[model samples]
Target chain A: MARASLREDIVNAAVEQFHMFGFTAAGVKDITDAAGAPKGSFYNHFESKEALAVIALERYGATRGLAALGDTSVPPLARLRWHFEALRDENLAYGFSRGCLIGDLATEIADHSEVVRKAVQDSMQQWCDALSGTIAEAQQAGEVTKALEADTIARFVLSAWEGALVSARSDKSAKSFEAFFTVVFGVVLR
Target chain B: MARASLREDIVNAAVEQFHMFGFTAAGVKDITDAAGAPKGSFYNHFESKEALAVIALERYGATRGLAALGDTSVPPLARLRWHFEALRDENLAYGFSRGCLIGDLATEIADHSEVVRKAVQDSMQQWCDALSGTIAEAQQAGEVTKALEADTIARFVLSAWEGALVSARSDKSAKSFEAFFTVVFGVVLR
Candidate 1:
């Protein structure tokens, strides 16, 4: 039980470093230092930095206040909007310094780390799958255009969203994200 | 003349490293070694790795097939589509491996490197400015909806497109980018 909790601490510490410095730039020593754990503990828990990043990506998602997005109880577009708004608020709270971990990894490490790359791909797939379900519902309810498949539209929405986050981070402001939310909710969806 | 050419070679090599390995992961030694220049020459030219990245980004954008996007001689929607299509083709040519350099920096380094971060912000700003011009022209011609400012719509399009590249890199396929092209041209533009 103690070991499991220590493992959680390691993962949690890793998320912050990876969030701040990227997967490759944030060394294992930094992660262990942040966790207050011995260097051996890092090796005992994860095989490589790539392994830790895969886990970090999941841990970041788990705590990002997006559980409600997958509830399926709320309307599709509303849930989608809620997810974006929450991200916007969180990003603003961080002063736009901390963008999405998975996105950061996807951009920087996807070409280099197959393990982390697969994890990012899976996370995105998971998000798209959940989003598509809601978008399908929206389409059936005549809330969205049916010209494209639920999955494809979901992909489109999700992709544009990732781009918006990048824009927000680059500008160090939420206007890019707000622009995304506005265009998505106001024009793209309509 | 020799010095000028040597500087160009350094930027070109650094871009490949940055494009493949990211800004932080691509070491200065690697960049200089790739350039066939003395490792110490790197410091003589740029104050920091962040400084080189700013220039690398500009060179990458210069080589991309987007010069005509700002020409204004072409129709607005046509220029916008051409801009995206050229990117899609470039990504496809790289087998969906080399994504946008500015986006890569925006995702991976925006928080840590202010120099690189501001450079990315400027690049996105320049793209939006050019895109807004074309979009505004399209709106005047009734080619696009006049419901929103060309700048906002341009921001939306640019953000979504950046997200699409992330998606494409995650999946190791161009389908996500192509989907973006389809949605923007078919649905969003209409």
Candidate 2:
């Protein structure tokens, strides 16, 4: 159990380090130091930094509040909006310094590392699948247009949100998020 | 003239290096080595890697074929689609290995370097401005809905494209581009 705790600590620190310094810039030593573990022990916990990033990406996805989309108490569209709203609020809380780790990895590391790329692909696919279910519910409820497939719309919406987060990070403002809310909800979903 | 060529070569190589390896992963020595220039000459051409990144970003923006968005010969909406198609084809040509450098930088370096962040902001702003102009023309031609401001729609479209590129890179597929075309044209602009 103590060993498992150490492993958990390394992953927690890795998520933050990768989010802050990116995959290549944030060395294993940095992650170990942040986790308060000895540098040599990093190898015992994970095969390599790339392997740890896969774990980190999964951890990040679990915290994305995807469960909100599955809540039966709220209208589907509202649940969808709340899900993105929560994501936007979190990014804003970081002052736009930390965009989505999945997105960050997708842009920076996906090209070079097949392992990380597959992890990102899986993470986004899981998110899109959840969103597709909610969007289908909204379509059935007559709350959203059925002009497009739920899966297609979900993918595009997720992509737009990812892009908006990148813009928000670059501009250091929430204007992109507002635009996302406007067009995604007002125009696309309408 | 020879000296000027060396300076230009460093900028060109920096663009490719950054696109492939990202900002933090690609060192100054790597960029200089790729340019076939001496590592020691790197300081003579640029003040810092961040400074070189700004220039590299500008060079990258120039290659994005934004001029196609302004060709008066084509209908404004067609021009807009063609602009994105060109970008998509370029990414396909690279086998989904290289995405838009601006987006790559925005996600990876924007938070860490204000100089690179400003450069990314300017590049996206310029692209958005051009897209806004094209979208406005489409609105005036009664091809696109005028319910939303042209600038807002332009920003949203650009963000969607950026996100799609990230997805395309991660998935190693063109499905996101197809989704972008379908939604951005079929739904949002409709």
lDDT of 1 by residue, A7-69 (tens): 888899999998888877788999898988887788888888888888888887676555676
Of the candidates shown, which would achieve the greatest lDDT relative to the real structure? 2
DockQ values per model:
0.82, 0.84
Local distance difference test scores for all models: 0.83, 0.91
Off by over 4 Å in 2: A1-4, B1-4
TM-score of chain B of each: 0.93, 0.97
> Against the correct fold, how does model 2 do in TM-score?
0.98
Ten contiguous residues minimizing lDDT sum, candidate 1 chain A:
A61-70
* Poorest lDDT segment (10 consecutive residues) of candidate 2 chain B: B1-10
True contacts kept of 1: 0.87
* Model 2: pairs clashing at backbone N, Cα or C within 3 Å: none
* lDDT score at residue A147, model 1, on the 0-100 scale: 80
A1-114 in candidate 2: lDDT tens per residue?
A: 346588899999999999998888889889999998889888887998899999999999999988889998999999999999999999989998889999889888888888
Lowest summed lDDT window (length 10), candidate 1 chain B:
B1-10
